[model samples]
Target: MKNRKPLVIGNLTARIPVIQGGMGVGISLSSLAGSVAACGGVGVISTAQIGWREADFCKNPLEANFRAMKKEILKARQISEGKGILGVNIMVATQHYKEYVKEAVKNGVDLIISGAGLPVDLPGLVQGSKTKIAPIISSLKSAKVLCKMWDRKYQTAPDLVVIEGPKAGGHLGFSREELETIDELGYDEVIRSVVKLVREYADKYKKKIPVAVAGGIFKSEDLDHALELGADGVQLGTRFVTTKECDASMEYKQSYLDARQEDVCIVQSPVGMPGRAIQNEFVQRVQREKLPIRRCHHCIVTCSPKEIPYCITDALVNAVEGNTKEGLLFCGANVWRCDRIETVAEIMEEFQ
Candidate 1:
């Protein structure tokens, strides 16, 4: 087959079909997103607790998030030198989702890739803005739901669609039982189904909606697999972690370089979702004990302070700060595949 081409999403096209998946709690910020965008890929910055570095982050996390969101996107645009697409990843499960969308649109982000929950009202939020909107779905049912809902309620279709399978990192969309039967569910089959839906909806709305598959896509062959399954592109998370421009600390990057196959596993997120991550000391301890929540940052509305396993915010902050043993090392299912640190340009060459 011929080589895969650039991904066309709405009015923006990425020379590289790879979209650098957004990582949170300090990962995949200005440095990582900007470098990836400069390499002709769609670079995504995660707005999940992005303001942890601000001076009054703990006291006013939401305010810090709003301030940092604009700053990070502006920085990414500058780094790309206006050559590549810069996008933001906002979670539907995040508190004040509309505000986050407003911040990105106000800053003129080229795209907004939202996940962690179905963004039904996303179209209304970006109604008058030029920011292209995309939703991250893990199943064909969710894809149909979003497409049908957006069409009927907002008279618009998604600019792009991201099919994030169970193998992706962070908050997953599948249930624990479904995650176990993912292989039986046949990932290729699911991707093809979503691809079909994207094409169908795109035709119905008289627009083009590109489909991208995420999770366990670490190598060129993996991209080929998704494309062959009818996906126009792929989104990767773990591979970008070891990149030199990654915003994660050296110790954090080292953990990726040093990870073994057995070290990567499916851990339960405090948000009540199953996520892939590196098995660390803190993860193990949290699994065995119910830790207390000191201060609720009002992250996810569904997260009950006393009911969850541990405080995800605190654990992730520890990881962001380079405290490996005490942090939650969220990573993709292909975490073990990352063996060395390379520049963003060099890593992009691997796909070429």
Candidate 2:
């Protein structure tokens, strides 16, 4: 592993190849991101309803998000002290997806890791900036499609390709039926195939596209396994949740630390995708009744207040703020294994 070298995406480099996968609605903001970057890892902040904690977020959700994104990026850079990578995770399914990328690039972000949907046109948005693009893919088919689209349309390939497996948190790339058979699909086998699939494109385009694997990655052994399977790096999300620098409240952090293996399960998200989360009282309530969304934040174009269940924005914010009973506690499949809270530096040491 010592001979593997650091993660290099375009001009930016991370001393450690672990990217702290972005957790949103206030999780993994400046505090967490900055600490990870300063520790020589790529730090990512999720832009999903990023400004929910802001005072004026409800009235003008879009405007508030733009302002908060700028602030978080600058704060993370300051924390990094110009070391490692400062990146943002903006979902392609976001209502104003292009605007988020333009704003992040405008503020001189180091990287944009787009997922939750295919980001075929991401390159065009960051054309003039130093920011690099990495599209998250789950299967060999998606990987080939993304590479082909980018190559034909922009004459380019991804600077980095992130392979997210089924055991991931938040919204998943797989369908509900597929989530049930995660073990049958075999995560290790899937990663190896996708890595092999992308290598051809990397060689053909004459680019050293670093392939990173995300999902259920916990410690040093997990990191080794991903590398052993042919990935250049591993993206750590659930492990970061218990860190002191994590932006979520103490209760939120404790939830991960307190979770048991049985406590975690796949639940349906309002965005029409299945997600892994803690099976808490909040989750049970959502399943029992259709809690109406009183108002719309206009976050995702496909969402509506009058038609959907509860407002994901409200639920996630509640979770971030420590309202355990009513909060939507999104987590990875391995989150229940968390035993204690540690610093970002301490956790990064495991991978080192």
Candidate 3:
């Protein structure tokens, strides 16, 4: 009913309640994030291996990422021209997660949305800064647990809460078995439960904790459905991939455009998680046989160089750089629906 309402997280506000889901390894960076922010939506930069393009990335990954993170944030601010909200998505499973959070806070990022694990210490990390914090949750159980933990530990509540359903792209919160029977799982009910749970905490903490739903949200009806389900906003990743300002190479966007329903499948990530992605030569190869890890970028905390099937960072970089055959193409369940490349403004207009 209130689909046109702004998404307000503490003092930060976006003109539209649409938060562009952050994609990794160069997918959502300065260009994409800035463009989305400029269009009045909350634009998020994925800090996963964000420094891949830096000259000393391989030699010094963390330093490279830190340097690149600041640069990207600054560039995104310039592109946004003071419109909308700019946030960064940092996975709790990432190595040196605290450092990434500190760097983003140091740069005065408007918000930090974290997931892949419960970010219990997030509030403590941004204690003195004006940077708002939110956690990505899929179920009411996780929502209650995180809210309780953050409240007990730091006496603070999240500024925003994002519910990432099974249909989302990249590494998911649901298990492989759960994802297999996702349609039968009735995720909308879970969304409602989380919204109610967050409202309870919002009352206790005396602040608004807006809930946003992610996954399979592509059309106007989808946005309406989320708002009707009591969500304050929607976070979308797949639809943005085909946008003109997306940071990924043209070939990467083409993969989404060329995708058929059957072309999308779930794969096991080397980080010991199940992920949704486009089925390709590389995906098939990884499923059947183990690909040797040439070098470790020290990206994920759970990834073992000797045991993992493939280097996730390397695969993602390949895809983002246009080497589709050898790259991993992460996508959403509705990736097949993306038929054309549009501008960020055009995409934002649809939600408006």
Candidate 4:
């Protein structure tokens, strides 16, 4: 194994250069995030419908989410015991996106990773806070646009940047058509281009903007590949799902253990984006016909309850709760490679 350097962003540092990507809808919560952080890696909690289990969630989802977000951040801090980094992943498309950012900042999270859309106002949102901001982008074009906009608007650059490719899980940045022919996309070249562009901006701004690559980053070899491509770190989501400390139910983890390469497929999410997931009964049924939307959780900004196929929140909640038959199991392209459950410490040790 090669010696790896720590991941540094502003004043914060992670002993390991691996970030546990944020999985949503009760999947990656305090338990998972805190565990990873304790292991000297950046552990991220997804703020997507994070308050699903709160008693007031059904009636006052936003308030419930705000309260839960604060509690989760505090709990993760306690669990981390002052080690590594704790960050929150807030989707730009989520309802009350600004409020969620404020809540995360107010809770004093170490970092904020935003995606699912370009988080153009993120710099302004976290202006005076010690919380670092990173944007999740898919292409060089988007990266250039974001850097230019942030530099021009706020006189600042991203503290870190995450490049999430087509193989990533849940609410991807690519079009459905583009994802279908992803084999011909030459995404590695894109990664290199984005890395080079970010380096230029880093030089111009006179600061370090560490770049991390997400999607299909499953093992130690994959981490080496990303570093070889000029990335400072790797962000992994699916690889952590089967971890013993992950917040998802045992049955949800089993879905990954049972998955085969052929079982992974792309699906159109109600959030108006393409996502990669294990093709289960619920996914197949949605592809065949539109399922009923019992009620809207008001999760995302683009979701239209009456016309959409099904509620993403409901499906994800089901998956986290162990209803594999009906839940939407969002996973990375390499999920099939997962064979067993391990602790966060064990997974972090592999990167070392």
Per-residue lDDT for 235-303 in model 3, tens only?
Answer: 999999999899999999999999999999999999989999999999989888988877889999999
Q: After superposition, how far is residue 304 of candidate 4 from its true place, in Å?
A: 0.6
lDDT of 2 by residue, 244-342 (tens): 899999999999988999999888888888899999999999999999677789887777677778888889999999998999999998998899989
User: What does the lDDT come to for candidate 1?
Assistant: 0.88
Q: What is the C-alpha RMSD of each candidate to the true structure, in Å?
A: 1.5, 1.3, 1.2, 1.2
Candidate 3 versus truth, CA RMSD in Å, comes to 1.2
Candidate 1 stretches greater than 4 Å from native: 1-3
The total of clashing pairs for model 2 equals 0
Flag regions of model 4 displaced more than 4 Å.
none
- Mind sharing the TM-score for model 2? 0.97
Candidate order by lDDT, decreasing, is: 3, 4, 2, 1
| Predicted candidate 4 versus true structure: per-residue lDDT over 1-352, tens digit per residue | 4669989998999999999999998889999999999999999999999999999998999999999999998999999999999999999999999999999999999999999889999999998899999999999999999999998999989999999988888878899888877762499899999999999989999999999999888888988988999999999999899999999999999999999999999888887888888999999899888888877788999999988898999999999999999999999988999999988998899997
- Give candidate 1's error at residue 216 in angstroms: 0.4
Number of the candidate with higher lDDT, 1 or 3 = 3
**Cα deviation of 136 in candidate 3 (Å)?**
0.3
Give the Cα error of residue 228 in candidate 4, in Å: 1.1
Q: Single out the weakest 10-residue window by summed lDDT for candidate 4.
A: 176-185
**Each model's total of backbone clashes:** 0, 0, 0, 0
lDDT of 4 at 134: 98
